[model samples]
Target: MKNKILLVLIAIAAPVFFSGCATDAHYVQTGDKQQIISAGKINSQDFATAANDASRNLLSMDPNPLDKVDRSPAFVVFSKIVNNTDQSVDQDLLTQKIGIALTQSGKAQIKIVDKLGEDYGNIDDFLNDKKTTRRPDFTLSGKIIQTVDRAGRTRRGTYSFQMSLNDPKNRAQVWMFEKEIVKQGTRDAVGF
Candidate 1:
C-alpha cells in the first residue's frame, strides 16, 4: 500500500504548499505603517502629511488673514503651483486637502477663476438674466521641491512643500508656510 500512502501524503502536502505560495490582500488606511515607501518618489502619505501640516500652520496664523476680510467667507483663488520634482505629481493631492480644511474651517471659499468657472458663470447669468460680479481677495500659490541624498546602500529623499497666501489687491503676502517630509531606507527596502 506504498502507493496509497504516497497519494495521501501528496494530497496533504499540496494544500500546504499552495497556501504558502499565495498572498492574501487586504485594505489598509492611508499613511498606515504598512504603506509602501519609495526613496526616489513622493508617496501619498507624504502628500497627506504635508497638506495637514501646512493647513494647520496657515490656520494658526496670528490675526489670521482669512478673518481680516470684510466678507464672511473670504474668496481665495488658486494660482499656479510649480512642481520642481523629477516625478509627475497631481497638485490636487496637495491643494484639495488644504481647500477642504479651509472650507470646513468656515474661513475661506475656493473660487475657480479659470475658463470653466467663467463658463458656469456665464450660463448662470444667461439663465437668471442677471450679471453677478465678484473678485478673489486672496491668491494661493506654492511650489514643490525634491532633494535626495545617498550614503552607500542607503538612500534618503526630502520633499518640501512651500505655500503662500497673498492679497492681490495690495500685493502683500498675508501668510506663508513650508512643510518638509523625509523618507530614508536601504535601496532594497520597500516599506517604512
Candidate 2:
C-alpha cells in the first residue's frame, strides 16, 4: 500500500518537474505582449504609456485644436521632477521618451533650459548681454511616486507618473496628465 502511494506521488510530481524544466525560446514585442512583467522596476512599456497619456492629454485640452498644427510648436523647457520612489530610477526614462514623442508629433519642441543658458553663457549673463533671447513657451515638470503592498506571497506595486505643461507667459497650467501603472507578483514567480 505504501509503495502504491509513493508511486502515485511520483507520478503527480513528474509533470511539474518536467514543465518547470522546459523553456522554449521565442520572440516578444517590445513593451507589449510579454508574459513576464517585473515589479519594483521601471520598464519600456511604462515610458510608452506615460508618453502616450501626456500627448493625448495635451491634444485633448488644446485651447485651439483647429490651429494646433498651424501654430508654431511651443518650446518646452525641462524643469525639476521629484522621484519619490525607494528604488533608483533614471528620470530620463520618463522625460526623454515624452519629449521625443512630442517632437515627433509636431506638437512641441524641447528646449534644454540649462544647455541653452550654458551655450550662451549663463542666465544672469545672458540677461545682461545683448543677445537674441528665445524664451521657452511651456515648461514640463512633475514627479513619480511608488507604493508597494503585499498579501502573503504576492506583491503588488503602483507607480504614479504625473506631468504638467505650464504656460510661463501667463503662469498657468495649460495641460496636466497622470498615469498609474499597477504590477503584481512575487520574485519567485518566473513569469509574471
Candidate 3:
C-alpha cells in the first residue's frame, strides 16, 4: 500500500515540477526600461552614448575638416581602437555607430583598411598598380576603459570612451573627445 501511495504521489508531483519552468521569452530594446541593467560590465546603451558624444564633438570642430574640403568628403581611416576594459567588447560597436552618424551627416567618410593592400582601399587594389586610393586626411583612434568599485552589497562601475582625431599631414591630434558612463547597483544581484 505504501509503494502504491508513493507512485501516486510521484505522478501528481511530476507536472507541478515541470510547470514551474514555463518561462516566456521577450525582446527588449537597447537602453529600454526593461533592459537588464548590469553594474559589472558595459551595456549597449554605453556604446550608443559614447558614439553620440564622440561624433558630435568631432564634427563640430572650429575648423571643420569636412567643410574645408573643396571637393568630396574628407577621408578618415580607423586606427587601432584599444579595448582596455575588463570585459571583452567588439570595437565595431563603438566605431560603426559613430561612422554611420558621421557618414549620414555628409561630412566625413570612413575608409576600411585592407591588410593585403598597402593603403586604405579595396582588396582588389592589390592587383592594380595605380595608386587610385585617396589618402585619409585624419586617423581616428581611441581606447575604452572600465573601473569598478564595491562596498559590501553596493557596487559601482564606470566606463570611459576616449577618442582622438589626428591629422595625417601634421601627425598631430586636431580634436579629442571623451565620454564617461557610470552605473551603480547592489552586489546582492547577479553580476552586479
Which candidate has the top score in lDDT? 1
Write one digit per residue (lDDT tens) for candidate 3, span 72-166.
68777776678888788888898899889888999888864423243634323323424656656667888998898988977888888999887
Per-residue alpha-carbon lDDT of candidate 2 for residues 160-189, written as tens digits (9 for 90 to 100): 999877665555777777899888877623
lDDT of each: 0.81, 0.70, 0.76
Checking candidate 1 for backbone clashes, the offending pairs are: none
Which candidate tops TM-score?
1
Worst 10 residues of 1 by lDDT: 114-123
Ten-residue stretch with the least lDDT total in model 3:
120-129
Query: In terms of TM-score, how similar is model 1 to the real structure?
Result: 0.77
User: What lDDT tens digits, residue by residue, belong to model 1 across residues 1-192?
Assistant: 999999999999999999996768988888887777888888888899989998999889888989988886988877667899999998888889999999999999986433323533533343353545456667788899999999997888989999999776666788988898888887534357
Q: Candidate 1, 126: how far from true, in Å? A: 23
Error of 2 at 1 (Å): 17
TM-score of 3: 0.73
**Ranking of all candidate structures by their TM-score, best first:** 1, 3, 2
TM per candidate comes to 0.77, 0.71, 0.73
